[model samples]
Target: GAGWPGLIEAYRDRVDIPDGARVVTLQEGNTPLVAAPHLSELTGCTVYLKVEGANPTGSFKDRGMTVAITHSLAEGSKAVICASTGNTSASAAAYAARAGLTSAVLVPQGKIALGKLAQAVVHGAKILQVQGNFDDCLELARKTAAEHPVTLVNSVNPVRLEGQKTASFEICDVLGRAPDVHCLPVGNAGNITAYWKGYTEYHGDGLVEQLPRMFGFQAAGAAPLVHGHPVAEPETVATAIRVGSPASWENAVKAKDASGGLFSAVTDEEILSAYRTLASREGVFVEPASASSVAGLLATAADGRLPTGSTVVCTVTGNGLKDPDTALAGMVEVEPLPVDPGAVASALELR
Candidate 1:
C-alpha cells in the first residue's frame, strides 16, 4: 500500500478479479504515458507513447496475468498453462510462481527470444518446445487445459482482456479524454480488442465524448488481419507479433469495424527503423514489435490516411531488452583506445 497500488487495486470497481480471491499481483500496470515531441512535430499531431514495457515483466502481458492468475488460484487450480511467442510465457511464469502454482509454457521451438525464454526458465516454469508454430502451440495449450486441471491463462481467457482494458482507462484518465487515434501492434489481437472495450465503456459512461479510431499494425510477413486470412507460415523479425491465426480474431474484427479502425502491415525494415528511432531519438528502448505502432503512425500519416493535428497515442508493447540479439545485430566494432585521453579526444574529433 505504500507504493502505487497494482492495477486491480487501482481500478477495483472495473477490474474483475474473482470474489474471495487473494489478489495475485506483481504491482503491474500504471505505466507511463510519455510525450513524443519529435513524432508530434514530424506528423503534425500530438503524439504520446503508452510505454507498456514498464510493466513488471517488461511487457503488457503482466496486466492480464495478474487477473488471470488470481482467478486461477481462486478457482482452486493448482497449475496454469499458456502458449506464447515470448512475452506471455514470461508473464505467466512469473505470476504463477508468485501465486505458488505450477506453470507450464508451450513455446514454438527456436521462435522465442533468449531473454524472454530466460525469464520463464528462471521463474521455474516447465518449458515445452513445440515443433510447430505459435498457433499450433496455443491450440495444444487450449486442449491440454480443457482436459487437465490446469487453467489456461492465455488471452483466450475473458478475464485476461478484462484486466487489459484498464489500459484504456489509464489513457483516458491521463489525457482527460480519448485520443483521436490509438495505434498499436496487433499480434494475437487481444490488446486491440481490450482497448476498444475499455474506450467504449468509458464513452458509454459519459467519461469521454468520443472514442478513438484504432490503428492496428502487423508485421508484413505475418499480417493475417490485414490479409483477412490466416497465414500458414507467419515469419517476421518482430517475433512478438508473428501470429497468423490470432485467437481473438472475431473480437478484433468487431473492434476494427465498430471503432472505424484500420489494420495495416509494415515491413521489417520499417519496424527496425522505428525501433531505432524510438531508442536513439525518443530515449525509449522498446522491442522491434513494440515499434510497429510508430511504424503504422508514420505510414498512415505519409499516405494521408491519418489526419494531421490530431491527438494520437501509440502503444509500445515491450522493452528492447527482451531481444538483445536484434539490437546488437550488425553492430560495428570500434577500435579500442590505447588508454590515452588524447586518443579519445581525437576519436571524438575534439583535438
Candidate 2:
C-alpha cells in the first residue's frame, strides 16, 4: 500500500528472483490505467490508456530494467550493457546506478531524443555513439556482452521479458478480466512479445476468462513487420521506434497470429496527429512512438475493424517529455495578457 513495493515485490510470487538476491528497484510499476473519454467516443469502444509514461524513468522499460539489473548483480556482474534508442538506456542506467554497477549504453549517433539522452547521462551511463542504427548497436552490444563479462540487459535477455510481462498482470488485475483488445507500439518488438506471453500465461492459469487481441503498430518508415522484411536503413520521426530489424521478430509475429491481431503501419503525420490529440483532447501526453497505438486504434475503428462497445486498452509506452522537441516544433499560439484583470478577462473572452 505504501509505494506499492515495486513490481518485483508486488509480483514476487509470480516472477523469479535469485535466491537471496539483492533487489534493485525504483518502484517502477503500478502506473495509472486511465479512462479516455474522448478516445472512447471517437472509436465507439470503451477505451483506456495504460499510461506507462508515469513510470519512474518515464517509460515502460523501467519495469524490465529492475529485474534485469537485479539478475545482473546476482550473477556477479560488475557491469551491464545495452543498446537503446532512448528509454531502455535510461531505464538500464538508472537501475544499474541503484545497484552500484557500471552501465554502457550504445546508441545510434545523432538519432536520439535530447531528453532521453540527458536521462542516460544523469544516471551515470557511458553513452556510445555508434555509426549505425539501433539494430547495429544491439548487435554490437550483444557481441560485446558475449565476448566479455559485461551482462546484457536488453530485451533479448529472457529476464527482461519476464519482467515486462508483469504489465499485462497489472492490467488484468485492475480490470478484473482481460479486455477485448490491447494495442501497443512495436519497435524491437519485445513489448508485444512480452504482452502476449503475459496474457497467455494468465489465461492458462485461469486468472482471466479470456485474453485480448494484440494489435501492434510500427512507424511507416520503419515498418519492417508490415513489409515482411528488414529495412537496412529505417527512418522515422519517432526515434524511440526507429528500429530496422527487430530482434524479437518471430515472437512478435506469433503474438499477432495467436491473438487474432494484426500488425500495420502509420505515417509520421498520423502519429503526430494522434500524439497531439491525445495530449490536447485526452490530456495524455506520450512520446510519438507511444501514439502509434492510438493511431492504429483510431484507424482500425474508422475502417470498421474494431468492434463497437468492446473494451480496448492502448499502452502509452513513453512520456512526451522524453521528446519535447517534436511537441514544441511548430508555432504555439499565445495571446499576451497585460498586468491587469481587465486585460486578462478580455483575453479570456470574459469581457
Candidate 3:
C-alpha cells in the first residue's frame, strides 16, 4: 500500500493503456539497479546489474504480464494463454490468477525447469505439454487464441512490449542518463525490442542526451540472431533462452542496427562460468540464461569491443531459484558432519 506503485501507475502517461481501463498489477516494477563492483573491476567499466529477478514473478515477464492481463480483463476475456519455455508461463499464470481469468500455458514436453512449472501449476494454470519445441508451442497458442475467445499474452501481443519498455526507463531514471552499453539475453527477442523502443522514446522526449548501444546475447546452441537464420532444434542448458525462432526478430535486428550494437553467441560453459561468478564472486544469484548478459559483457570486454571507462548495464533476467536443477548441478557430496562446531569449522577449513 505504501510502497512502489506498479509500472503502469508509475509511468501512466508514457504507457499506452486504454482510458478507464482497470489496471491489473502486483507491484511488479521498480527493480534494483545494483552496482557490480566485481564486474566493473574485471571489465574496466562502470558496471551495474538490472536485477529483474526481483519482480513479482521472479522474472522480467511480470512487467509485460501485468499489461497483457490488464488488457485481457478490460476486453472481457475470461481466459489468457501463452507459450513459454518457463518464465512466461509462470508470470502469465500468476497475473491471470490475479485477474480472475483461466490461464493455459503450452510448454515443450520435458523441457521446462521444475520450479517454473511448479509456479504455473500452483497458480492453477492448465499446463499443456506440447510434444514440440518452443516455436511450435507458440504457433499452437497463436492459432488457439485466434480460434477461441482466449486472449494471448505472449510477447507477440503489442501491450507486452509497452510494459517491458519500463525497464529501460527505470535504468535511465536511476543513472540520470543512459549507460554507454546495455547488455541482455535475447530469447524471443521481445526484451531487446522493448528496451530499444524505451531508449529511443526517452531520447526523443529529451529525457537523456544520448542512447546506449544495445548488446543482445544468445545461447550458442539457440542463436538464430547470430546465425542469421532459425535453427530447427535449439539446445542449451539455459532453458529460459533456448528458443530458435524469436518472435520479435525484425524489431530486435532493427534495434541492433540502429544502436550500432552486435549480437553474439555464448557457449553453455561460458554462461555457467558467468553464472557461478555472479553467485560466488558478486553474491548475485541468477538463472543461467541471465548469465548470458554478463558472459557477453566479459567476452566483449576481453576482446576490446567494450571500451575501458564506459558505463555498462547488464540485465539478469530471472532468479536462480527458478531453475533448481541447474543450481544443484555439480553440487559437492559430503559426508554428514557431526553435530558440533568443530566439524563445521573443519569442513570450512577454518581451524
Q: Please say which candidate is ahead in lDDT: 2 or 3.
A: 3
Q: In model 3, which runs have C-alpha deviations exceeding 4 angstroms?
A: none
Report backbone clashes per prediction: 0, 0, 0
Q: Kindly report which residue pairs in candidate 1 clash with one another.
A: none
Question: For residue 337, what is the lDDT in candidate 1?
Answer: 91
What candidate 2 gets wrong by more than 4 Å, as runs, is 333-351
lDDT of predicted model 2: 0.94
After TM-score superposition, the amount by which residue 96's alpha carbon in candidate 3 deviates from its true location, in angstroms, is: 0.5
Tens digits of per-residue lDDT, candidate 1, 14-53, equal: 8887778999999989999999998999899999999999
The lDDT values for all models are: 0.95, 0.94, 0.96
Against the true structure, what is each candidate's TM-score? 0.99, 0.96, 0.99
Ranking by lDDT: 3, 1, 2
Q: Which 10 successive residues of model 2 have the least lDDT summed?
A: 330-339
Which candidate wins on lDDT?
3
Q: Comparing candidate 1 with candidate 3, which one achieves the higher lDDT?
A: 3
lDDT (Cα, tens digit) per residue for candidate 2, span 1-351: 365889999999877989999889899899999999999999999999999999999999998998999999999999999999999999999999999999999999999998999999999999999999999999999999999989999999989998899999999999999999999999999999999999999999999999899999999999999999998999999999999999999999999999999998999999999999999999999999999999999999998878899899999999999997898899778977778999888777996
1-351: candidate 3 lDDT, tens digit per residue:
568889999999888777788899999999999999999999999999999999998999999999999999989999999999999999999999998999999999999998899999999999999999999999999999999999999999999999999999999999999999999999999999999999999999999999999999999999999999998999999999989999999999999999999999999999999999999989999999999999999999999999899999999999999999999989999899889999999899998
